[model samples]
Target: MPAIPTDAVRVADVAARIGGSVRGDAGRLVSGVASLASATISDLSYFSGNRRGIQPDKTSAGVVLCQSKHQDALPSGAVLILVPNPQSAFVDVLEWLFPRSEPTKCIDPCAHIHPTADLADDVTVGAHVVIGAGCRIASGVRIGPGCILGENISIGSDTELIARVTVMNHCEIGARCVIQPGAVIGSDGFGLINEQGRWRRVPQLGRVVIGDDVDIGANTTIDRGALDDTRIDNGAKLDNLIQVAHNVEIGAHSAIAGCAGLAGSSVVGKYCTLGGGVGLAGHLTLVDGVHITGMSMVTRSIRQPGVYSAGTPLDTNDNWHKNAARFKQLERIAHRVQALETGLNALRKNDEENL
Candidate 1:
């Protein structure tokens, strides 16, 4: 684990870094960051919303980052940085306080690189990494320990593949991307045809193309297409354990949460969000700005941009059983109600004719 910095920063310097103004004494020293509930006099904490149920008066933080709406809620003599977006500004401050160390630019002796492989200056190949023939690694790229790159793979500049990542044949990873550990890119898609009770495997000839600034989570598996490329567009964020099937096109800036499964050939439009455990059937389309809640199942195409959800609310087992049993009798109940209405109408007509 990397050590946290012991150095302290002035309250005024932190405000200047995030383009905010200091409200209290600017000379106070902030040595670390902590949560609002556990803050001390040496720690800086932030309050962005009331959803966390934080009490501002109980906090003993040296500095607090907050929006203008919550400034009056703070205790007296509290040092503060007022920003438009406290979360984003706090992220910037965190990055400024702790920067990542650059890896040494050298190929490990135990690694196997083919003679025909091309690598630019300043590339770092870690221990036991296997680079097949015709692979191209650009400058400032760090291939971590035990990574395997298949033939004809192209990795762009400044991309970091943390330990044990596997990129199979002919795939292309764009610049400034962070692929977490155990992510398998360009694996064969689940394409099979049934022939006389035996499964015949279809050839996967396409690649998995990842765009710039993409962050793929740990253990996420992206399959190669059967005939075309499976693409993840720029700035899209995919969480852990996501299964992106063959030929699926995820639009730019779309975010899919953990355990979400997108079936083959599904086109997700830009800025869409799918919550955890959401499953979409094959060959469907979700329009831009669509939001699907957690554990929802999408069975058809969504042409309009809006929030959609489908799942039964939870209930006790006894009540659920009664409701479910009544639900199964709906067709029979409707037929009986229609017959009763018809008989009543006939009786009313006979009485009117006699009068």
Candidate 2:
């Protein structure tokens, strides 16, 4: 393990680096980072929302990052780093204190690369990585251990593939993309046919095209298309365990949360937000600005832009049983109400006839 920084930075230094104002105990010493709930006297923690403000007074954190509006809520004798947006400032501070790990320039002997593969001068290939023929790996690309890149693959500059990422043939990934471990892109789509009562596999003949600045989470699988390529637009962020079927087009700046499944031929528009566990049926289109809540089942196309929810919330055991029983009798209750209305109308008609 690398030696942690022991020198405590002055609160003024943090404010100067992140362009924030300092309040209360400017000379406080902060040596490490911690969460708001478990910060110690030499650690720094941040509070951004009301939900996170419950235990600030009880925390022993030496320094606290908060917005100017939250100054009154801090405990006495604690240093306060006030910024316009505390969360953003906290991210900058964390990045400054703990930078990401960069791989050193070492080509492992066990790595295999074809003679026709064009690799840049600064690229790092880890152990057991196989780069196939006619692959072009641009500058600063890192291929981790056990990765397999098929033929005619183009990985743009500054892209990173973590361990065990498999990129099949003829796929193009743009610059600054981070593909996590166990993510298999450009695999054959799920195409099968029942020919004479026997299941036969259909060959997937297209590639997977991923755009720039995309971050794919761990264990996510994106399949190649049958004819047209499956396209993921720029700035799209996919969370872990997502399954994207063939010919799916994800627009720019869209975010899909973890465990979401999009079937084949689905078109998701730009700026759309799909919550975790959401499922989109095949061949459906979601227009731009659509926000679907968690566990929603989108069976048809959504042309209008709004927030949609489908799944029911969890209830207590007894209340859930009662509600479930009531739910089943909803049609019978509706019929009783209709019968009452009909009897009242008949009485009113008799009175009118007598008058």
Candidate 3:
């Protein structure tokens, strides 16, 4: 909100780009974007006029994006740019307000690329990056500093690997994907066998195949499969610190929040949303459109598409202890209740016979 605009963006220009009609001060200029609570006269904001809020009437934003139906809802304090979907239009205007810088299209002199690695002309490789043998990097791909790519990997066009990412052997990254810093792709899965009372390593023999338009967050790890490739479908999103185990298949358009984990062979169907801190047990399958709430432990496969939650609600320490104790006695209590019911039914039968 407290903007120091190197140059001002005209309200009319933004409206023209986002397909909105301006109702006030088409010539007004805003320097930056901010929330309604902190927006200044130089900042642009948005109001979802479907909801009633005092912020819309009191906000002093220089320009505002809102629906055409609520043209009269917001006070005349800010210039209104009316559109069908204000939230989506606001994002479209972000390119003009805060444009991203294009990376320099050149391989760094200090980068270590093997002779067998085939890179496109427009690819950008940062300093200290190591590209191993038989790697194929497509056009418009950007590899940030200190990244390490192993053998026979294929990164699709326009994909970006942020600084310090590690992609192991035989992985395929799709186009328009953003792999954040410290992400590990194609890491060895946790596959071990009990051999004569000793733990023996099971060689993970598969690759990780990532589809297009995926956004892998910082520090997320995806392991290689035990036999078949572990696949992440197109348009899937993964948050920071997530652990995807071996042979896991995440379907198209699925979203997973931070700190969630999937055990080996777990499959998540398309359009599913797993909340933060959710855990899926091994070999379980979640159906399409399923949503699991935060902190839930999924012990079995979800057959239907719906919002699922588990774990007991929070209570006082004493009350929780009492409830937990009663849980253990449920089987005995059921037996006693069944005995009383049987006695009452027998007495009722005898009374009917006497009558």
Model 2 lDDT tens row, 145-259: 9999999999999999989999999999999999999999999999899999999999999999999999999999999999999999999999999999999999999999999
Q: After superposition, how far is residue 317 of candidate 3 from its true place, in Å?
A: 4.4
Cα RMSDs, all models: 3.1, 2.7, 2.7
In candidate 3, stretches whose alpha carbon ends up further than 4 angstroms from where it belongs are 1-6, 49-58, 68-73, 315-322, 332-355
Residue 55's lDDT within candidate 1 is 86
Off by over 4 Å in 2: 1-7, 331-355
Q: Lowest summed lDDT over 10 consecutive residues: which window, candidate 2?
A: 1-10
Clashes per candidate, residues 3 or more apart or on different chains: 0, 0, 0
Where is the poorest 10-residue window by lDDT in model 3? 49-58
Could you tell me how far off, in angstroms, the CA of residue 120 lies in candidate 2 after the best superposition? 0.9
For 1-355, candidate 3 gives per-residue lDDT tens digits of: 2544468878888889998899888888888888776788878888875454445777777788888777676667688998898888877777666666899899999999999999999999999999999999999999999999999999999999989999999999999999999999999999999999999999999999999999999999999999999999999999999999999999999999999999999999999999999999999999999999999999999999999999998999999999999999999999999999999999999999999
lDDT against the true structure, per candidate, is: 0.92, 0.91, 0.92
> Clashing residue pairs in candidate 2, if any?
none
Count clashing residue pairs in model 3.
Answer: 0
Q: Alpha carbon lDDT of residue 38, candidate 1?
A: 78
Estimated TM-score for each candidate: 0.91, 0.91, 0.90
